[model samples]
Target: MKGPIAILGARSLLGRHVVNIFQELHPDVCLEMWTQSDGVGNVNSVKRLIACISEAELIINCHEARDLSMAPDREALHFHNEQFVAEVLRNSTAPIIHISSTLVQCSDFWPNTYEPEREASKYGIALAVKAYCKSKHLAEQELFASHRSAVVLRIPFLYGEEDWGSPVTDAVMAANIFGSIPNIGDRGGAFQIIIVGDDTPVGDVYDNVVEAVAKNPKRPMSTYNLPFLPLYYIYLAIGWLLLAVNKIFDVSGSLSKMPDPSLLYLIFHHWTFFNTNKSTNLLPDHEELSREYVVKKSRDHYALMNPNRVRTSWQLHIE
Candidate 1:
C-alpha cells in the first residue's frame, strides 16, 4: 500500500486515470509509467520494464490496441499482446493486474473460457475486431497458463471523466455537442447490452486492483467481470446514427472519427452483458451508477466545454 507500482500503457486513458487514482488513494505510493509511444516493445523499454518489475510490488497492464479498423495483422497483434505479456511474465515476480476486454467472450478461440454466450463466429464480427479479441484471449490464456500471480478484469464499454475514447464517449458527443439523439431505424431499441464498468468509474478499477494486490492470494490468477450497465439501446442508437452521419457527411470538418459499426453492433446486438455479482461480492465499496448518472455527468462536462457558456470568465476548453 505504500510502495512502488509500475504501470504499462501509462499514456492511455485507462492508464492515466489509474495513475491518478493511485495518487489520490495512496499518496505515498510511487508510480512508474511506460507507454507505447515511448517504445514499450523495444529492447530498452524491456530493460526499463524489467527494472520496474524488480522494484515494484505491483504492475498494472493497461495496454491495448484501441483501433480495430486499422490494427496490424494477426501475427503482429499476437506479438504485441501475447509475446509482450510473456516477456513481462518472464521477468516479473510481482503480481500483475491485466485489463482485458469482454469481447473475448464472443469467440470460441479461447479454450476453457468462462463466457456464457455461445461462440460468436457466426455473428459477423469485423475482421480487425476478431483479431483484437483473439489477441486479448491469447494474452489471458498466457497469463493463466504461465502459472503466475495475476488478476484479469474483463471490462466492457468504459465511460468516465477524461476518457481517451470509446463508443460511449462518441454517444456523449453526439447528444451533447450535435444535439442529435441516436436512432437505430425502426428497431424501437430492441437490443440489450451489458456494458461492464459502465456504471463504475475508472478509478474504482484501480482501487479494486489495489485491494486484490493487498490480499496477495496464493492462487495464480483470478478473473472477474466488472459491473453491468443498464441497457439504454435508444441512446446508443443515437450515438451510432450520429457517428454514421459524421462518417458520410464529414460534418466535423476534421478526421472522420466514429466507432466502427461492427463494434457497435457487437455490443448492441451480439455481446451478452452480465451482472457484476463477482466484482461486487469481492469489492463491496464499489458503487454502481444509473444510466441517468453517467448521462448527466457527461452533459455537465460538455456544458463546461460549450463556447457559449461563461464560467468565471474562462473560455471553453474543447478536446
Candidate 2:
C-alpha cells in the first residue's frame, strides 16, 4: 500500500508548492492537508486531525509565520509546535520534517556566521526568531525527543509566487506602477537586490528531508543557511539588462524626478537566497533561474494583479 502523508501547513507558500510537487510525484499516496482557517487551528477543521496524525507515516510541518518586520504571536507560535503538536506527534513512530526559517542564523553572539539553530542573531528578524527559536527548536526537539526520526530545514529568503501573496517581484513593481518616482540617488543605474539570488538548489533541501527520513540511523536535525547574496546578483543583472533596453530605445524620462533609494533599497537589499549544505549539493543537478522566462512571467502576473496601475514598466513592449 502507498504510504500516508500529512502536510501540516498546506495553506502556506512552501506547503502549497511542496504538496503539489508531492502529489504530482507520488499520486497514489494518501495526501492529507492541514491548515488553520477562520480562527480555527488545524485540528478544528478536521475533527480527526489527531487521528490522522496518529496514523500517518510522514508528516511535513510547513506552518509558520514568515513576515520579518511584523510581530508574531510568541505564545501561540510556541504552543502550537511544542505543547500541542508535540503531544500528538509523540504517539507516532514515523519520521516528521518541520519547515522552519533561517531567521535564527543572522547572529553575532556565536563564534561562527552559520551556527546551529541554538545560536541565532538577535537583530530584526534574527531577534524575533531568537524569541521563537526556543519553541521551534523545542518542536524539533520533541519530534526527535521520542527518537523516532526528524529533519528541520532552516530556510532563508524564499522566492516565487503564490495565488494570494504576490510574487517576489510584486514588491519591485509596486513603485514602478505609477511610473518612475524620480532618481533621488545615483542615476547611471539603480541597483535593486532580489532574494539571495543564489542558484542554490533549494529543491534539494526538500529532497533531503524525504531521503533522510526514509533512511536509517535517524538523521539529526542539521540547520543549513540559504544565504542571500546570490539573489541580489540575479536581480542586478536583470536590472542592467532592462537599463540597456531603455538606452537602446531612448526610453529615459522621469515621472517624479528623484527615485527614493531608501524605498528602493528597502525592497532590493534584503532579497536573498540561502546557503545550505543540502541546497548547494542539490541545486547543481537542476537548472537555475531563467531570466527571460521570469521577466515575462513577472510582468504578466503584475499586470493581472494590478490592472489599474500604470503600465510604463512595460513601455518596452507596448510603445
Candidate 3:
C-alpha cells in the first residue's frame, strides 16, 4: 500500500468522492487517476491503460456505463462494462478494488452461479436497466475468472450534494416543485440508498479498500455489500412536505417536470436493497443517516443551487 494507487473513472460520482477522501485523509499517498476522457476504456487505449497502472501497487476501478437510455445497444454496454474490465485485468497485476452495483441482483437474467438471487424483477423494469445489469454481471464473472486478488464492493442507490442528476435528487426536486410525487403502482417500489459524497460512508468504503490492498486476502476475490439504509418508495412524500415548508417560509424555489415513468419504475418497482452483514463485519464503524436527514439535506442543497427561481405550489401556479 505504499506505492502509487491507480483510480479508473476518476471523474465519475463515486470516483470523485474516492479521490477527494483519499487526498483529504492521506495526502502523502500518490494517486494515479485515469478517466473516460483519458481513454481508459477505449479499444485503442489498451497499451496506454497498461502504462497508466504499470507503477501502481493497487488499482481501484470505478468505471461503469450508467446511461440507461431506451433501446440501449448491447455492444455499448459490453464495451464499457465487461470489455473494459477485461482490459484492466489483462494489463495490471495490482490487487484491485472494484465498485459495482446491487442492481445486478434484481435482473432476471442474472445467473445464480455467482450468488443467490436476491429478488424477482418487477414487470416493467426498462430494457436499458436489464442490459446494464447483464453487462455488470458479466464484468463480475470476468473478475472471478481472472484468479487475481480483488474485492468487489456492490452498492445500492447513491445520493449526495454533487449527484444533482441522480434519481433520488430528481425525486427531491420534483417533490419540491410539485409538492407531491407521482404515486406509481404500489406507492412506487422499495430500495436502499447510501451517501457517497458524505464523509462517513465514503470513509468506510475507503477504509475497506485500504484493508483489501493491505491484506491481499488469500481468497482470489471477495464480494461485499456496502452499508445502506432501507427506504420505501412512499417515504419520498417526506421530501414533498419538507420542501412545502421551505416554500411557506419563502426560502425555496421550484423546478418543473416529474421523473419519467421508466426511471420512476426503476426506482419504485424493484426491491434493490441488500444485506450488508459482510461489509459491517469488515468495518463496523459505519453510521446510518435518518430518512429525514437525507430528505432535508437534499432539499437545502437543491434550494441553494436554484435560489433565485420563483416558488410554485400544488395549484400548478407560481407564487
lDDT of each: 0.52, 0.45, 0.55
TM-score of each: 0.62, 0.56, 0.63
Span of ten consecutive residues with least summed lDDT in model 1:
310-319
Answer with 1 or 2, whichever has the higher lDDT.
1
| Count of backbone clashes, every candidate in sequence | 5, 29, 1
Sort every candidate by lDDT, greatest first. 3, 1, 2
- Candidate 1 residues lying further than 4 Å off, grouped into runs, are 70-76, 107-128, 172-181, 185-261, 268-271, 282-295, 303-319
lDDT of 2 by residue, 72-99 (tens): 3456666565665565565466677776
- Deviation in Å, model 2, residue 78 alpha carbon: 2.1
By TM-score, highest first, what's the ranking? Answer: 3, 1, 2
Kindly list the per-residue Cα lDDT of model 3 for residues 118-199, writing each as its tens digit: 4224323533256666787788878878998988877765555555444444434444554533233332234455665332
- Residue pairs in candidate 1 whose N, alpha carbon or C atoms collide under 3 angstroms: 181-238, 182-237, 182-238, 183-238, 194-273
Compute the lDDT of residue 237 as modeled in candidate 2: 67
Candidate no. 2 TM-score: 0.56
lDDT of 3 at 113: 23
- On TM-score, the stronger of 2 and 3 is 3
